[model samples]
Target chain A: MTKRIQQFLNEQKPATPCVVIDLDVIKNNYGSMRTHLPLAQVFYAVKANPAPEVVNLLVNEGSSFDVASVPEVDLCLSQGANPDNISFGNTIKKEPHIAYAYSKGIRLFAFDSEEELLKISRAAPGSKVYCRILVENEGAQWPLSRKFGCEVEMAEDLLCQARELGLVPYGVSFHVGSQQTDLSQWDVAMTRVASLFMTLQERGIELTAINLGGGFPAHYIEHVEEMPAYADAVMRAIVGHFGNRLPKLMIEPGRSMVGDSGVLQAEVVLVSRKSNDDCKRWVYLDAGKFNGLAETLDEAITYRVTTSRDGEETEPVILAGPTCDSVDVIYEKKEYSLPLGLKAGDLVQFHSTGAYTTSYASVNFNGFEPIKAYCI
Target chain B: MTKRIQQFLNEQKPATPCVVIDLDVIKNNYGSMRTHLPLAQVFYAVKANPAPEVVNLLVNEGSSFDVASVPEVDLCLSQGANPDNISFGNTIKKEPHIAYAYSKGIRLFAFDSEEELLKISRAAPGSKVYCRILVENEGAQWPLSRKFGCEVEMAEDLLCQARELGLVPYGVSFHVGSQQTDLSQWDVAMTRVASLFMTLQERGIELTAINLGGGFPAHYIEHVEEMPAYADAVMRAIVGHFGNRLPKLMIEPGRSMVGDSGVLQAEVVLVSRKSNDDCKRWVYLDAGKFNGLAETLDEAITYRVTTSRDGEETEPVILAGPTCDSVDVIYEKKEYSLPLGLKAGDLVQFHSTGAYTTSYASVNFNGFEPIKAYCI
Candidate 1:
């Protein structure tokens, strides 16, 4: 275990499962990002970990926000973030939510469809709008399907239509997919953005900015390239694609910024063999898919788990959450080894789980309390 | 559209996505279960839908509760349910929770492990304990994995241990799996329970009650046999296996009791083709996996979706939720047909969504509001 996790465990001594976020690590992560990409501005994706403390820390570090909804805009604004620095990143939004964000003085927004652009025109007139281009998210840890962006033809039409409807055709944005590991994915997305930029330039529209939506990978169970390596690859790609005429660039880093700053501490509810003849042992934890770790869906993100009982003989076990729901098993097919002496009341820590842990927690499924977060 | 749904849409005119529950349907479903299984006591599983109105209505009907946690016990007690009618159904529980339930005058509980039995003995001494026996959940609509229950030998050992630990070895319980459609699955499970009962009796511990844990099916896209058919099948299987020496019988119904009583109304955010050359259309709704319809995990439960503009020309479309996440796609592999006229601001209703909808909702994911429910 890292010193940060050990210190947190020693201090908090949590009886119930809780997420501990180290703000100092977040600050260091922010500094590292700024040091690597000197020209690019950082807009922390608020949806990843919307804890007010996380937002406030980023705000103190002079980070902008890429908000998805009216409440996200409000969360950033409430934490003293400037509304001018916030962008509505979600393409599919309710009209009233658009108006609500507009009422709160958020001018920049993202849209993919003509209907959405029309709603933006009506709700927030003359606002800065970015059209997202659909990209292949192959090899991404969490491969996003066709959900947010439109095709190149649709993007071109949507941008031109935005100008016709009295909205500023501000820029282009694209997400390579969350927990994106491969650096070449950024090159592919940036090349597409560059092509769209030139197409729009030929159409006599001068775009002012390029919003690089969040896809930065976090170190979980697997090793990823360092932050500076990703930053170097991104900067080199942008320069190679756009050369000297790069638009005012911004990168929204959700998982990369916060994933390593927190650790989730959950206690073992029980450890038993299902049957005497059964091969594997079952270790059940107090926290599960519903309470905090909903990102464990389909085992997309594999978090490294460690128990307080260390340096003993280890055995492969099927990890499960403390719920009557059978689907709540966290790890079964995958081989997860834990100390053989692990039993009930032992603390188990899931490392590098800050980003998607608490934000996706359900309030009361199977009557378990939502995962609580404590910031240090 | 069903008259129940049409009346709801016409009457409520919900501007945002909401769950509409018909109390009359719930009352009728409860009455049907009682009529079909006259000998079995009803313990409505609170985790299905923890809506206060549902609990209070069931309380008025004198229904017992199979609660998973202390808050569930408190919810029942606060709703004026008698302590004797509530069973602490979850085997995985914290020590404080057991003590709290005991302090609240709850005596019936379930356990499947030695550690749990020890905790109960220390906290809630002499409580009526049930040991859940593990069985193959074959052919069930939602086949549960090995997250809950233990094997026959484990159950026998645990029950015997419960008596030695100063607890009442009261009964045996087993879940055939949620949304169970196969009647023969129950026969196999009950036969195992009978064997365990006889073994426990040989050890001088008389097991009085038998908890036929929740598995009852609900009508969704596929047709299920009515309540009487299920009850009759269950009765026949019990008589065939137990041979008239049935213990004090109880049935915990979660989905079947309330599933058909509710309808979820969500407005279409947008309807568009992925590209000009693409064949199928994509229909987006305000509610998705994170908010209310979490039962869509792995497409285990296929809900029937309809819109107010029914009977119009229809086309196969991909359905998705409003969140920015890619995994939020509700239907992609499956072919779901919707009206071609479906557009922004049009209302779509998902039928038979009363159970497991709102209770599993996250508080705020991508800043969307947690799904709200209303009762009539």
Candidate 2:
């Protein structure tokens, strides 16, 4: 074990499952992003892991917050974040929630439709709202283009509707996609967003913020390294297109900001060979895909299984959760191995699990807290 | 809405996001499974939806239960399932869980390793254990070959180990992957399982039960009609192999028995657009991926999205959850036209959600119950 990890394990209270967030790592991540884009207002997308400690750390690191729901807004408010510093960046739906968010004095909201603009106007009159454009991340498998955001043709109509509804149109927002590996895609998206800005200005609407929505990859995975290149390209495009005319440049980064800072530590509940198949042996842990990480099975992100004990090595094994369902698996590869022969009670830490690993995928299918998260 | 669905919805209090289980639908599903596999013991895998009401319904319908973890065992027991009937199918992990399970008199265990046999010997002593085999369904995209089950060679060793430990090695078990659409694949798996049963007999192990582990599909979408053919092929294969000597056949059917019984009814919270594009519109619901049928996002389980007001036409829309993360989407390309335009406060029902949708996915992502489940 690394001296630091050993100390961390010693400090823990033997919970079979829990999320440990290293505040030091978080601060370092914050500094890294800050160093790369000094001009962009960094808003930590709190939905990734909105634990109070994580939020507090991001706030302490001088980053604002981007919240999509009322509970998230409440979480930030409870943590003493000024409402002015928050952006309810999702398209507002519930008129009541819009009023509630506005009542809490939240100003920066993201809207994508004329209907949503009309509803928000009815709920929170004259609210400052950002128009989200649906930028196509061409070639991405799971693109958000089909679900949310305005296509280029409809973007002007929604912006005009917001203006008509007395919702002060701030700037524009666009998300390329989550875990975006292609850095140059942002350049194409930026050009589209810039054109929208020009078109909106021609329609007599002055914007205040241009939110490049969060999709920055930040994990120990191989793909996370591509984030620096993506971030650089995004920032350069923002500067190149908008330049002095840029609204308050906002970047809501969820995975990139905190995904690496959190480690999901679970105990190897049972390690048993199912058969003498040429495939990998099975190792069941206390955690599963229900914890919002089906990707372990989807093979989206790889998990590096490590033990807290020093001099341990990995052996190839398949990983499953304690759930009775056959689909309850975390890792599917048989060729992978851990250094330590992970037995039932040994702790296995999955690195770079800070983001959607817990908050987004938790289902108490087996009736257990997904994982109790603690910030270091 | 059907009369059954109307009654169920009428009983629910307006919670932001919750699961509603129609008791009538559950009974119907149970009956359907019973009618088809009249002789086979139906062990309702509690890992699907462990709600006591759901389990109780199965018990009343004359179905036994299968549990993996201790809590699941306790959940079934608390619901009045016979302790002897509840199979603790997962390999024992913690000594305490095993000890407790044995004290509760759980005899049917799925054993996969040498350590598990040793634990069972020390804990239950006289427990009847089933040797789990890793049957490969070559057609399954994410096969279980690497996760659980022993290889044929290891099974012989493990069964020998069980006999040495004085454990009652009763039978063998294998599961085709979940949401299995291909019925022909089960033929290959069963052939291998039947071969293993004979192989074990050759090694002087008299096997009793040959459990074809559950991967029964439930129609959440139009393609769900494929389930019946798959079931027929499997049952015919099982009967063909053993020919009335199929030693008390047991199938751990979780989703098929109750998947259509449960519905994820969520309130549409926000409807907005994707930024930097034109035509993309997002319908944000109060429920996020944390609970509102993440199987739709994770496994691409296509669910039928409809309104409580029956006969209403649907609209093409992107459904999102309330979680702040961009990845917290429910439907990506699932085109469904709603009866009316989805506003903030209307209820959206996801059909065929009785299985892995609710029980397995609820995490306290935002310190909220992803879904509140109630059986009608």
Candidate with top DockQ is: 1
- Every model's DockQ, to 2 decimals? 0.73, 0.45
True contacts kept of 1: 0.71
Cα lDDT, all candidates:
0.87, 0.72
Residue-wise C-alpha lDDT for candidate 1, range A1-376, written one tens digit per residue: 4586678679868656899888888898899989988788898988889999999999999999998777898899899999888988888888888899999889999988778888999999999999888998876889888887889888988898999999999998888888888888889988888888889889999888887787888888878889888888888889999898778988899998999888889999888777767888899899988887888877888899888887899999998898778888888887899999998889898888889888798868887888988888
RMSD of each: 1.9, 3.8
Tell how far residue B168 is off in model 2, in angstroms: 0.7
Instruction: Please provide, for model 2 over B29-86, each residue's C-alpha lDDT reduced to its tens digit, 9 standing for 90 to 100.
Output: 7777677766678888887788888888777777888886777887888878888788
Query: Candidate 1's residue-wise lDDT over B1-376, tens digit each?
Result: 3476568768868756788888888888888888899889999999998888999999999899999888899999999999999999988888888999999999999988778889999999989999887888887888988778889988998888898988999999999988888888888898898888888888898998889998898898887878887898889888987787778889999999999888888889878775667788888899999889898877788999888788999989989999888888888877898888888899888889999999788878888888888887
The docking category that best describes candidate 1 is medium
True contacts kept of each: 0.71, 0.59
